[model samples]
Target: MKKLAVIAATGLSAGPAFAATGPFFSLRNTDFIVLVSFLAFVGVLLYFKVPSRIGALLDSRAAGIRRDLDEAKRLREEAQEIYASYERRQREVAGQADQIVANAKREAEAQAAKAKADLKSSIERRLKAAEDQIASAEADAVRAVRDRAVQAAIAAASSLLAQQVGAGQRSAGIDEAIDDVARRLN
Candidate 1:
């Protein structure tokens, strides 16, 4: 009914203005033949259900487009998930790397401390050894000096006694002094 009203309005509005050469309904008129042909073409399209088929085709195309859009959206979401997973892995790797670095630092510090302790011990041992050697040398030097002094005193006393005493007394005193010196040395 709406189509009929639109057609009627179109006919009434364009009829007189365009059909200027002759009677608008006459078979000889070009405008009338053209209008009839156009109407016949429209009627054939309607009779064959072409408009419905076209609508169906358009609906199927739209559905295909919607499916494509949905697939694209799903793919985008999957990509985002993959990206997030990679980011999480990256963060984990970074954390592991940090942990490794921390461990290495701790190990290095421990080794350094151990080395320092070893070095200190080594130095202390060397110092103790050096002190022992020095003490030994000093003892040897003091003993040598004491021995030299005792020998000098014995020589001086023997010389003085030889000069001061008579031969017989000197000999007897020397025997007694020798016995006393042997006893004292022991």
Candidate 2:
């Protein structure tokens, strides 16, 4: 192994021995052709493959942009739908509130009407009671007046009859008449 390593090292130390057999001018002339060939090879590669690679990259970017635009449009439509649904709900709630207010107003009006009717009925009952009291008082006054008038007439007749009859007989008749009235009252 050491001998092989020494032999390899000796071979590598020897100067570069490979050289072209042609004259230097011929080789210098070939450099121009080689440079042109390399440039043509690069140009052909650009013409044939670079545009396709670039087109693929551009298409990928365009597809991504299109997808983003479509997503944005879809999201906008969804937002608009949600807003419209919310507005519809608001309208329904407002309508229900209006209906509730109307019902409350109707209920209040009905209650007011009932209260007014009750008040009227109570007033009528009070008025009837007052009228009855007045009528009873008037009847009692009429009876008292009639009884007083009858007593006055009886006294006047008794006085007149007393003047016509003898004193002793008139006194006995007056006493008997008073006794008869008392017995009838019992």
Candidate 3:
């Protein structure tokens, strides 16, 4: 409106019909008519649809820009959400790994304790078995020595009986042998 008023004022002031005509202006009315006609043509074109076509094109461009902005915002939000979810999953995995490690450590400790106990029991059993074997061996050795001693005593007694008893002195030598056996037994 202000630009239109300026154009109107300039047109009215430059007209010879409103004031004195200048020497450089011969067809002032013609210039004024041409100016009004041009302004009318421009106004008619704008009023009809030429400006509206250009405005609709600009409005569609603006809408496209807004859509692009909204899409970018939504995509950015989705990326952020994905990053957050990934970080959460990573933390959970780390926690689970730590739990597994702790459980493994505990299990290993339990297994170690069980193995130590088994080893100790096994050693005790082996020691007991060794002791039993040693006792048996000692008893066998004592028995064998006693058997050898008994055999040696019998051999000596037989040799003495054979020596002391001549061909005719058997009864007296037998009596002596009995006395010697009694003393040896005591």
lDDT of 2 by residue, 1-186 (tens): 999999998887662332434453453556556767898998997978987888999999999999999999999999999999999999999999999999999999999999999999999999999999999999999999978876786687688768877978998878776676556544
Tell me the tens digit of each residue's lDDT in model 3 across 124-158. Answer: 99999999999999999999997788668867876
Candidate 1 lDDT, tens digit per residue, 66-180?
Answer: 9999999999999999999999999999999999999999999999999999999999999999999999999999999978877787777788789988888998877777677
* Candidate 3 weakest ten by summed lDDT: 20-29
Best by lDDT: 1
What Cα-based lDDT does every candidate model obtain?
0.90, 0.84, 0.85
Clashing pairs in 1: none
- State in Å the error of residue 155, model 1: 8.6
TM-score of each: 0.56, 0.49, 0.61
Highest TM-score against the true fold, candidate: 3
Candidate 2 deviant stretches above 4 angstroms: 1-82, 179-186
Clash counts per candidate, in order, are 0, 0, 0
- List the pairs of residues colliding in candidate 3: none
